[model samples]
Structure formats: structure tokens, C-alpha cells
Target: MQSQQLWTVRWLNAIGDVDREQWDKLALPLSTPLLEWQWLHDLEASGSISPRYGWQPYHLTLWDHEELIGAAPFYLKSHSGGEFVFDHWLAQLASEYGIDYYPKLVGMSPATPSVGYRFLMAEGVDKQVLFRNMLSAIDNSCQQQQLSGCHFNFIDELWFAQFPAHDFASWKHQSYLWKNQDFEVFEDYLQTFKSSQRRNIIRERRSMSKQGITIRPLNGQEIGTDMAALMYRYYLNTNERFGPWAARFLNGDFFTRLFQNYRHRLLIIAAYTDSAAPPIALSMLLVKDGHLIGRYWGAETQVKDLHFNMCFYAPIEWAINNNIKTFDPGAGSPHKIARGFRAVANTSLHRLYDPRLKILFEQIIDQANDMESANIKALNQQLPFAKNTRPV
Candidate 1:
């Protein structure tokens, strides 16, 4: 056996240029992010999504002599804001410590935070070997560029056991999900809730229905370019009203192209006024395989319980109807619990290059994990249901 120089990293603006069959073969199991070829290509083709906007595509590939053994969806980020796990504080602290933090390296499924970000390895290749070599390459890239630290956000379980050796930082980010365990219907799932909470849900839906707020679920093909702009407008309006920090990672054209190509994997639940010709509030979700993930939502005008109804309940109800295995109602909201979205732990591993910072973050992570675990336990105990009531 000849030990040849193997594994290299190459960036592709469009997956179209890559060998589609081979890439998808490895991409499928490496992450649970999404399986939409057209959507990702849309992001690249749009040009709005680039290092120009603080996100530069950096795809890491591992080769054995002459063959492709692994690949990771990565980026060179100018800031750490959009990953959904707040590292602005870390960036601030880094500045105080006189460390360059911006323009850092990232290993993630750019703009999406649904976990499962790691290098995709081809069959017959030992994953551990690929990870080690890939880390060395990543370190080399960072060092040559003299950039700050690297982050693997919302990482996959496979990377957790291996990332430590690579000196990556491990951060515990907050994520919650609702699971379906043979739940036959929405009603069956509702039975797990307390009577009061169940009644509240019933009332929210009934109120929306009474006000002629009916929801329509659309896919990529069903969603047109106009709706894409409308969605972005609403997204911006909501962001403005809420906070500047609530801004989305993508632009209008990205959504338009996304719906055009990857409609099969999309599940958009739009809320329309009964008497109106079209939707007034739009909620977009991604349905790939057996999982339903709520991504974004916005309304032109605020309606009573509109956010909860459109964002959480409607999409979740659809997930139940569609027999989805899990529902991630995007980012955060304690109100998710009131709507039956339960607390669940998500793993995010990191590697800090600086030894002193590493020691400090290690201690912080220990406390953070403990706090998260206890909080989850408390959340479960505080379920609106009576103490004697058993979850279905």
C-alpha cells in the first residue's frame, strides 16, 4: 500500500459543477440539514450570499491519492451573528483580550441552523482518519491566512467524539424539538397537554378560523417569485418591529429561486384572510424525508395570536398530519412549550485554538450544559398538565 498525499479542499459556488451523484451520496447521511440540491445552488447563484456579505463558501474535501473520500460544507465568516448561537459576546471578549475574532473559519451548513454539520465522508473511508487529516488541513488554512478561530456550529454527533482532538471549541447551543412516537393524529398528540393548555390551542385555531384566517401549505413550484418578495417584505417588517437582530440570512431572490427549484422539499403554510384573494401572513417550512422544520414567518399586519398560530401551531399540525418524525420550530420561543413543542437537547461542538481561551470556555461549557440539563428537567416538570397527568 502506497501512502500517497491525499485529501484536498475545493470550493464550489454551485453544486452543479460538482459530480452530483457522488456529492449527494455522501451528503445524504452526513447531515440532516436538507436534501435540496436546487435550493443550495440557488443560494450560490444568487450571489447575494457570499463572503461579500460575510459568508464565503469554503467546501472541504478529503482525497485518497486520486479519489474523493470526504467533503464538508463550510464557509469563511466575517462575523458570528447569523449562526443563531450567540458568539457576539465571545467576539467582544476576544477584542478585549486583543485577539482578532472577525473573518473566522466556520464549518456549518451556511444560513441554516438545524444541526448536522460535519465533513461528508465517502464509503470505505475511515471517518476518523478523514476528520484528523481534514482538521490538519483546516488548521493549515487558518494559520496561513492568520485568521481567528474556527467554528463548527450546530455540529453532528459524529463530529462530537472527534472534534476534541482537533482543538475545536464545544459550545452548547439551545435547541428544542417535538417528536412523534406513533402519534396517529393531531388530537392524539393534544391529549398529552393539560385541559387548559389544550383549550387555549383550540381557541387560537378557532379564533383564526372565525376571523377567516385559513392557512394554505404550498411547495416550491406552487410558490411564485411574487410571493418570494412578499415573504421578504413581511420578514423585514417583523424584524423591524421586533429587533434588528431578527433579520434573516437570505434575500428575496434566494427565496424565489429556492421555491422554484426545491419545491419538493418545501412545506409553506400561508395564512390568508378568508375574504382576501391571497395570503396575508406567510410561514415557510422545509419538509425533507420524515422531518418538518419551521424556518421563517411574517405577517403584513399583526393579528391576535398570529405569530403562534402561523409559526408554531399550523406548521406543527401539518407535521402531525404528514406523519413527520420530528418538528423543529426554528430558533427560540418559550411560548413553544405552551403550544406542545417540548424541550430537547441539541449538541454543538467547538474547537478553540488558543490554549488559555480553551481552558476558560471548557469551564463555561460545563456550567452551561448543567444549566441546560436542569432547565429541561424543570421545563418538563412545569408542563401545564396536572402533576398526576401522564404525557401521551
Candidate 2:
């Protein structure tokens, strides 16, 4: 057995440096699917995130003798492109203060916006002590390398409470989340909406039938390589339509690997002209621990309310059938409000090494959080649910 004083921190350039069993020993117990070894490894192996693309894997692992006790999936980010927490404004502020913000240490599941990012520690370990040690290691590395600071995005709310003791400040943001309030069926979900909005949802779902498109939910062994390839095409088409605003981080290879290795956690909602034909539209969701996360979706042809059907209604219905407790429809799209997704606060934590920058952020962060809270409150009010209706 090694002494606690002998704990060592090693920064890895690739996740493959650590054994998959060791990594999953920490990751498999997590509630979020994004942190699992298969997901992270696929992102790196597929070249979706690499130094050339501005995401350099710099994972941190803690060791005691031969025991791998803790790990944090980290990155040396050259630019903040896929990170959903908008920090371009902070980068500009750093520039004004003569700080080089690029290549900062970021801790999160790459390209995923849902929370549950925390340092993975072994069971029965002193988490607080380990957390402090990990933070110290990160701070030492940041200062030694002259990186601006470290940021942890979309942190697990429970773990987030532990950060203040370590001097990390919180930034508040909002995302749409659909909570299942013991809903047994799709109609039970619709009952939460007001009469007009409920009718609108029904009409939107019916539009798929009117266009001769049938939405099919396929999972597990049903998702084959060919279907995965088609989904990737739709993903690219969706991103291409947005041009500069596109967040197309994954490649075709990533989808192929995802289908092959991680299909058990995959749920594809496909819209086809008929059972004999290929899908014209597709929406992909990642499921784990009774939670469903909307990952990607796109349509080859234009159909009225097709996006709504594929992305929202179809997925929600499937989630209900599968007993999924919550559905995070991913980020952006105010239209999600009318579809029964409520505005929920998501948080990111920050710690700047420079005192000047830290002081500046402290001064403004509370006001920013307050404004965000107000926005969340206002948005929830606009949700097209009846006054007495609880979230479903």
C-alpha cells in the first residue's frame, strides 16, 4: 500500500494511456453516458477532437502506488467552439486584460452540454481531500505553463456545491429539460399543455402522417452500419445548413464506431416514407440511467413540422415508452418551450489564476447570474402549459 502523501498526478496526452478497465472503473458508475470510456475514446480515436482541431486531450489521472484512484477528463482547448457554455465574451475580456485565453484547461465531456462532470474518484476515498489535491495539481500545471485559467463546464450540481470551498466561482446558464412526471403515455404528456398548445402539438405530430412519413424508433441490435452511415449524412446536412453556426464536431467514423460499440445506449428516431423505404429524416438520442439526451438530427427533404416530429414528439413518446425519467433536448431553440421543455439552470465553474481577472469576474458574475435567473423565470412563464399543470 502507498502512503497518502505519495499520491501522484499524471497528465496524459491520450485517454488510451490508461487502461479501459481502469477508466471505466471510475466512469461506469456515473449517471451520464458522455463520460464513459467508449464515448470519450471514440471522440479521440475518430479524430473528432484533436490538437489540429483545437481540442488536445490532456486527461488527468491520480495514482497511489499501483491504484488508479481518480481521473478528470480534461482538454487543452485552443478555441472554445464546441463548448456550449459561451465564453467568447470572457476570451475578449481576457484579451483586453492582456491574457492569452487560448489553450486553457477545460474539464467536461467534449461536445456534450448536459451536466454530471466531476472528478471520478474511487469508492470510500476522501473526495474532498482528493478534490483539493487535484485542483492544486491543475493550478500548478496551469501556472507553470502560463495558461489563463481552468474552467469546468456543465458540472454535476451535487459536486458543484463542493467547489466554493476550493475557491471556484459559478456561472449560471439555462437549458431546456423535459421532466417525466410519472407520465404513463404520450397523451398524459400532452395533458400538461394548454388547450391551444396541446392542439398544436397534436397537429405537428399528425403532419408526419399527412406527408406519408412514418417515424420509427430503433435501438440496440436494430441499428446497423448502413443506418449509422445515413444518420451521419443527415447530421452533416443539418450542420451544413447552418454554415458558420454549425456545431458538427463528430465525423462519419465516430458514428460508425458509435453504432458498432455503443448501440446499446443508442436510440434512433427515423422518419421513413414507408417500411420498405430509407429514412428521409433522423434524430439520434443517447440514453443511460433513465435519462435521454438529444444528440443530433437532420432531414434530407423539407417537410412541414418534420423537424418537430423527429426531434421532439417522436423522441418524447419513445422516452415515455422506455420509462426515461428526463429528456434533455440539448441546447438552443426557444421553440422547445412550447414543446413541454422547461427552462432549467445549468452551471459552469471557473477559477482564474490572475487576480485582476478573478476580481473582474467576481464583480460581474453575480449580476450576470441574476440576469440569467430572471430570463429563466420569464421563459418558464411563457411555457404553453396550463396554470395548474406540473412538468411532464
Could you list the CA RMSD of all candidates, in the order they appear? 2.8, 1.3
Q: Which tens-of-lDDT digit does each residue in 1-392 have in candidate 2?
A: 35569998999999988889988999888889888889999999999988889999999999987788989999999999899989898889989989888889999999999888999988877888888889889999999998888999999978757656877888999999999888899999999889999999998888878878888999999987688789899999999988999999999999998989999889999888878878898899999989999999988967899989888898899989989999999987799999989999999989888888888889999999999999999998899888889644
lDDT for each residue of candidate 1 in 1-392, tens digit (9 for 90 to 100): 12325445665644556665667777666326453345556777786567678887777766565466777667788887667767776677777888777778887666777866667777776666767777787788877887777787777665567645665555565677877766778787677777888898888878987887887777757776567778877777777776755756677787777666667777877887763565798888887768887887888898998888788777767777777888888777677777766776666666666665566667677888788888887776656754554454
lDDT of model number 2: 0.89
Candidate 1 matches the true fold with a TM-score of: 0.89
Distance (Å) between predicted and true CA of 375, model 1? 3.3
Note the Cα lDDT for every prediction shown: 0.72, 0.89
TM-score of model number 2: 0.97
Question: TM-score for each prediction?
Answer: 0.89, 0.97
Stretches of candidate 2 above 4 Å error? none
In candidate 1, stretches whose alpha carbon ends up further than 4 angstroms from where it belongs are: 1-6, 11-19, 29-37, 64-67, 162-167, 220-226, 274-276, 386-392
